[model samples]
Target chain A: MRAVVTVMLKDGVLDPQGKAIGQALHGLGFPQVGEVRAGKVIELTLDERDPQAARVAAEQMAKKLLANSVIERFEVEIVA
Target chain B: MRAVVTVMLKDGVLDPQGKAIGQALHGLGFPQVGEVRAGKVIELTLDERDPQAARVAAEQMAKKLLANSVIERFEVEIVA
Candidate 1:
């Protein structure tokens, strides 16, 4: 199975990198962009037998290493 | 409309950060992880009228700023 994990900064958390990118985008003429929050996407090919197992494993991976729970939230999607 | 943009490093690109995270995961006991690539996710609340227009705007955003075309690719999903 293939899974994609997206780890994103929680709302209200300060993101300097995202702010910088937003500013750059504004300078480049995309003024409609009001805010930008940057996160991480991790794609994995797993040997899990089912989507439920994949979700559990992915969550474990996120909590254990892929994300900092204090500031980030993660969502998992299983792809065929 | 709300949109999510996920930008990922193309295969064969060196991802030192991902490698470090993978190493940390290994140390933390997730040895099933063979490789890791880290990318970015951006969420936006757009005022676009339709999905097709939103897609065009998003692609322009990705090409102009959100992603580096040389090393990364982006996918956009509209939520409501």
Candidate 2:
């Protein structure tokens, strides 16, 4: 099975990297861009076959290592 | 409007960061994990109201600034 886990900063957390990206986008002529937030997407190929099991495992991985509970949140999606 | 752009290293490209992540996961007892690929997800809030226009603009941003075309591939999804 294949799972995708997306880790994102919690709302109201100061994201300097995102701020920089927003500024860079504006400078690059994308004036329509307003707010920009950057996050991580980790695709994991797992031996688990069951979709529910894969999702649970991915979420466990997210909680244990992929996400910082203090400032970030994560979502896990089983793709295959 | 909200747009999501995912930037990933193309297949066969060396991804040291992803390799490191996979190793770390293995160390953390996720033996079921097989291959791990890491990518970036950028969320952009735009002034454009139309989803199609927002997607186009986001793709332009991805191509021009968000993704390193020589080694990276990008996908844009617009969600208002």
Candidate 3:
């Protein structure tokens, strides 16, 4: 089974990386672009096969180590 | 309108970051985890209303700047 964990900064948190990217896009002529937020995706191929169990396990990982819950939020999605 | 650009490393490319993440997961007791791959997601708020046009523009951004085409592949998704 495969699980995807997406970690993104919390709302109102300052994201310098995202700001830099937004600036870069504007400079590149994508002036229609507005705000940008950068995040990370962790694709895990796990031995677990039960969809519900796999999602629970992946979410645990996201909360425990994959994300800094204080400043970030994570979503776990099961695929395949 | 909103767009998402997901950038992932190509197969056979060495991923030290993914390795480190896997190790950390193992240390945290998620031993069932097999191979882990790390990627990035850039969420953009765009002024464009047409979903197709937004996706095309986002893909261009991904190809030109968001991702390194030599070692990465990017997918652009349009969202409201």
Candidate 4:
């Protein structure tokens, strides 16, 4: 099975990288661009077969290793 | 409107960060973990209201600034 974990900074956190990107976009003639937020996506190939179990395991992985709980939030989606 | 751009390394490209994460997961008792890949997601708040236009603009941003086309590919999705 495959699981995708999306880790994003929590609301109210400052994202310098995102700020830079947004500024760059504006400078590059994309004046319509507004606020930008950047995050990470991790795709995991797992031996687990069951979708429910895979989701649980992936969420655990996100919580334990992939995300910094203090400033980040993560979502896990199971895909075949 | 909001646009989401997901940029990922092309298959066959080496991803040291992902490899390290997989190793850590294995070491941390996730024996079922297999291949791992890491990517990035950028959420852009755009002034454009039309979803189609937002998608096109986001794709252009991905091509021009967000993704390295030689080693990465990007997908753009528009959300209201």
The candidate that achieves the highest lDDT relative to the unseen native structure: 4
What lDDT does candidate 3 reach at residue A66? 91
Candidate 1 collision pairs = none
**lDDT for predicted candidate 1 compared with the true structure:** 0.81
lDDT of each: 0.81, 0.93, 0.94, 0.95
Location of the lowest summed lDDT over 10 successive residues in candidate 2 chain A:
A55-64
Model 1, span B12-65: residue lDDT tens: 999898888778877887666667777888876567768887777777888888
Give the CAPRI class of candidate 1: medium
Q: DockQ score for model 3, please?
A: 0.94
Task: Check candidate 2 and list the clashing pairs.
Answer: none
Candidate 3 CAPRI grade: high
* Candidate 3 ranges beyond 4 A from true positions: none
lDDT of 4 at B54: 90
TM-score to true structure, per model: 0.88, 0.98, 0.98, 0.99
lDDT string, candidate 2, B1-80, tens digits? 99999999999999888888889899999999988889999999999989999989999999988999999999998886
Query: Per-residue alpha-carbon lDDT of model 4 for B1-80, expressed as tens digits?
Result: 99999999999999999999999999888999999999999999999978988988999999999999999999998887
Candidate 2 yields a Cα-based lDDT of 0.93
Candidate rank order under DockQ: 3, 4, 2, 1
Stretches > 4 Å off in candidate 4: none
How large a fraction of the reference contact set does each model reproduce? 0.49, 0.96, 0.93, 0.92
Per-prediction DockQ scores? 0.59, 0.94, 0.94, 0.94
**What is the C-alpha lDDT profile of model 1 across A1-80, one tens digit per residue?**
77788998998999898888778877887666667778888886666768888788878999887889999998998877
Model 4 / residue A2 / CA error / Å: 0.6
